[model samples]
Target: METKIREAGTGCGCPGNNAGALSSSTKGCCSPPDDVSGKYAVSCCGPESVTARPAGNQAEKRRLDIEFMYLDLSVCTRCRGTEKNLEEAVSEVARILEAAGFEVKLHKIHVQNEEQALALGFVSSPTIRINGRDIQLDVRESLCESCGDLCGEDVDCRVWVYQGREYTVPPKGMIIDAILREVYGGPAGAVHAPSKMEALPDNLKRFFAARRNKET
Candidate 1:
């Protein structure tokens, strides 16, 4: 499939005729910020998507301050679909908020096992969370058998694919809507909690507990 390149606007600081830099692997894409100073940074990836930091005070005024967590495998087919949906959702939301003078955050949930999946009540791939809450309209049981169908492992799942490429991020409009929902206290959506076993290597139990408490 041919990858499309979208133009960036002045606000994004994109150069003429292009939104941002693209990977040589892909046609052209919006590049992430050179430096991510805070919790997040606004990235001008392409015309389809742009990442930006949440404008705390401004967002509060626009009432669009919320954190979005996306649950998906790093390389699962179905999970990729979910990621695409989320990316579109987030990108849309970002554009909306930007127009409204608001901001949002995009977070990635890397689930490793059934325990973590169960904790977040993930019924399907690419689960979305708003402020640690699940936002999927449907709820189903998660399945993990093998990955042999797609690649190395036996557990395999189908994700969304638009043009043969697994969208690591979503388009613009969806993101804006998500943020709007979160700001108004709609629901943080489903929360993907790391399992006891999936804890970070650098962090011991104590550290994990502390971080978990904060997230909760």
Candidate 2:
């Protein structure tokens, strides 16, 4: 069986070297904001780009690829809780997946700097993807004290919505639902095509810059 874990600096075959300083832009990360009464809040980031695919040959065995991307898992409560839920969800379904002839692979990615965040097409902290498809389509964010302290500036992290309710950390059932959807097609199994973007969102750029300055 083939499995691996990747850290931020290790390179994930993203296109080009660090683009250097990020430029100021009026563009927001995702689509335009809707009315406050709407079910979904305005997303903090743009549509996710398919930055990775399942590793290894599919002809050999069925494969399930899971990627957990985040910033500061150690201090960010949101990131830490999300990771824990993801792990438990995977464990609960592992045996059933194995019996059904599926091989599961999990990759934990830590976004350390601006260069890596840009390369990974990361717009928000604490993202989870299955087979390169984001579990939650809507990307909402709220102020994260932990991440803000880590970078020495105000920062916002992802907020998850499940069954019409918003949560700081994604529910375990939501993660399992996403994984099962990838494994077995259903009405909601439509795969969203990844979109292209030129630069990182200003929100993320600020976070990275603050982190770098503090470290130096």
Candidate 3:
């Protein structure tokens, strides 16, 4: 599945690097704000420009990929919470990871509807995948009021079992553990796959279809 990609457009509502007037979407370590660009401009592979450095240093770069997949970050509490917690976890370990020669790259993907979700093998929303593997295994689904508001129907979201308790949102410690494990010889790579794909949950399909229709 391919994640949403936003092209650069003319404007001064951007930050850093291309602070001045620029042609269009300036890809970087992070995406432009939704209000600023309303586009998915950032790439998952860190930033676009890099200083000329030694090849030896490049070899030491342990690229840790992070993908926070969700239906709608603006509304879904679980999705929002998970994304924030994951970002914090990565931030907490970023310095250490860099010291250990690792670079952390995170991407927040918005799954438009059910079709996109299925194509991504997304069992539910607020799905956090590190290095192409879901941190929490065993896919399950449940009704989400937040999603319902957006889709105009009862949409299901994913759940996580943390410290013996089930949570609509994943615990910060869980994300920390996931990243730490990878740093300590965990066999893994980060996410590079596109979010949009051609894939299915029956109710989800209907819900997404309804959403698409409403938007159209």
Least accurate 10 contiguous residues by lDDT in model 3: 9-18
Global Cα RMSD, each model? 21.2, 22.6, 17.8
Off by over 4 Å in 1: 1-75, 99-101, 118-123, 140-180, 183-216
What is candidate 3's lDDT per residue for 40-102, written digit by digit as tens?
A: 343445566233322221233556767777777778887888888888888888788877666
The digit string of per-residue lDDT tens for model 1 on 58-99 reads: 222222223333333554444565566666766655665567
Q: Report the lDDT tens digits of candidate 2 across residue range 22-100.
A: 3444645554443334333445564442123223332333667677899887799999999999999999999887775
User: Of the pair 2 and 3, which is ahead by lDDT?
Assistant: 2
Superposed by TM-score, candidate 1 places the C-alpha of residue 76 at a distance from the truth, in angstroms, of 2.0
Ranking by lDDT: 2, 3, 1
Tell me the TM-score of model 3: 0.65
